[model samples]
Target: MPRVSGVVGHVVTFGRVLRQAGLEIGPNRIADGLSGLDQVDLTRQDDVYWTLRANFVTRREELEIFDRAFQAWFLRTPVSPFELSPPTPQSAVLRRIHAAGRPDSAAGTDESPAARGWSYEEILRTKDFGAMTSDEFDRVRALIADIAAERPRRRSRRLRRHHRGRELDLRRTIRESLGAGGDPVHRQYRLRARVPRKLVVLCDVSGSMEAYVRPLLLFVHAVRGSGKGVEAFAFGTRLTRLTRALETSDPDRALQDAARSVADWCGGTRIGASLKTYNDDWGRRALTRGAVVVIASDGWEREESGARLLEDQMARLARQAYTVVWVNPLKGHPAYEPLAAGMRAALPHVDRFLPGHNLASLERLGEVLMGIERRHAA
Candidate 1:
């Protein structure tokens, strides 16, 4: 075992060797390896070896090459500090691999920086959240903030002062007419007031959706910062409101607070029961009230009975909400279909069923919200 920084460099070097040895390794795979390394016990040789092998060696044939490269690069005899130059003739295969998948120099020279630069960001924007490396995930946080800032505002029922409203302002018209011997010469009209719509987010923080919860919560925080009325909730076995937790201006701190507040971070999902709790306790008071409800889940319920409860609650939510947008991260997969029991039961009640697997999909959601606002205003 070595320092995390040292191990990451060696892992990247190891990936290069495998590629040169005829294995089809890419930068994404290398990044994935580094991410895997971070999660495992680096001190354990077996843990370290498998972490690299899992990311770089995909095919059965590549395993032999990976073993040879791993032994040659990491397990070989130590050379003198002064002898540290380029790879030797025996190590040329690995050296050439590194050259082929070398990360851009413009990006910072760090383990996390391995997935930076504009080109990387472009790829990351559309990349599925479930497959993203730790570095890429970190970079996308700022992008999420920007997307949240662009979310559309909904019009409110309350009217505000307007210069040319359809309805006449009789009180104002009379006050002005007093100057002209009470003659109705000019008329003033009042228009409906437009306020930012309330955004209620019910995110599933279950084990199945572990990869997506962080990014989705960050999205919730962004929505809150956009000055809209945002109520955030996380559910696994039960529901926990995160509106106050996510109020911190700092994204990282807000997430930490939310994590602390939530009792079930990555437990089993009880979508139906959580929604029922929301509907029973908070729906009329804070959740509905003309708010747009956004539920981020994969639609996997624990039991058949839960699915039935979920369907009823979703139907009730649909009736009260201005819009019911279901953000399922699984929808991003090309072959994916909403055939899960909970998904099937709830889709009928959903107004906008969009993918929530990447920044691009979330941006499309922003567009969808804007469209709803435009239609409402019209």
Candidate 2:
């Protein structure tokens, strides 16, 4: 293979090419494609094409676009460095592809602005979910899944044999010692195994939180996909369980299924009544017991007596849950405060209050979940 220092640039630009053709190619996919290329004979066109295709194309419908892009980018001859004609979008894209495919030694003296540390992916991490366009959101969904995969762990009651365990497995040790003339030269030990902790998400899907609901639900769906100990519920005027609906592998289809499952997709806000219902039905059934409870809402309450009821429900929930996480998108704003009646009421019971306005905030939420400790709140 040629000294392709620009392989990173090539993969990144090629991802943009696929995205331009309406395919959902995220940064992670680009990174995967680059890694796949590393394991293959780059000089072999078929190997290169299939490697890129396997990482970039997610659906049968995207095959045609992927093939066209691969052909145009990898097979086409380099364009002239200087062009006489006025630049257009297609021409601009071709030029970028050509630039990305160029060898490092053939490159110009000036370094690209991206080499200086600022990249579009960095900007996207901090960009608010509410402001993202459809294409941007599509690209970001994969990153969201990666972040959600970091689930909190709890020590299981059942013990597993471990070399570093503190408790000696005397029975096993004695059984093995019989074969060694009753000398206990080797010893076995047991330790409680760490397993994923139960995660319960209660997302607000009311009209007030319309801009953030989709991303929040996507986060919930990703968390649900991580392992078995996850439950998701959506609430606006009422509570609706969405764990099964979001189980579909396809994010788009999963979102659609979740929408259909929730009767109040984007209707009135009744934070208190919804919490009360959850407590009565699911919480009493021990769904919330020792679980990491996450509530993604703007804290808007429509009912007149919603604040008081919300406060009481939050208290009950905190008592049952191992940890309570309150995620408010508005909190991302500089001047924002917990001024909403529902927010104000729920704060006392929340173990960790976080902003869920962007990918960075969500990443922080994941980190918090992974290292979260039980709170002794009253």
Off by over 4 Å in 1: 1-117, 150-155, 373-378
Q: 1-378, model 2: which lDDT tens digit per residue? A: 554888788888878877877788887888788889989997798998899988988878688777777777878844333222233323322232233233453244464434535577788789998898655565567688888877888888888999999789999999999999999889999999988889999999887777787778778878777789899999999998889878898766777667766767678889999999999989998999989999999998998899999999999999999999999999999899889988999999998899999999999998998887544431
lDDT of 2 at 134: 55
Q: Give the alpha-carbon lDDT of every model.
A: 0.78, 0.82
Q: Which lDDT tens digits does candidate 1 get at residues 314-340?
A: 999988888889999999999998889
Residue 149's lDDT in candidate 1:
71
* TM-score to native of every candidate shown: 0.66, 0.68
| Clashes per candidate, residues 3 or more apart or on different chains | 2, 0
Q: Name the 10 consecutive residues with the lowest summed lDDT in model 2.
A: 84-93
* lDDT score at residue 326, model 2, on the 0-100 scale: 93
Residue 317 of model 1, lDDT score: 90
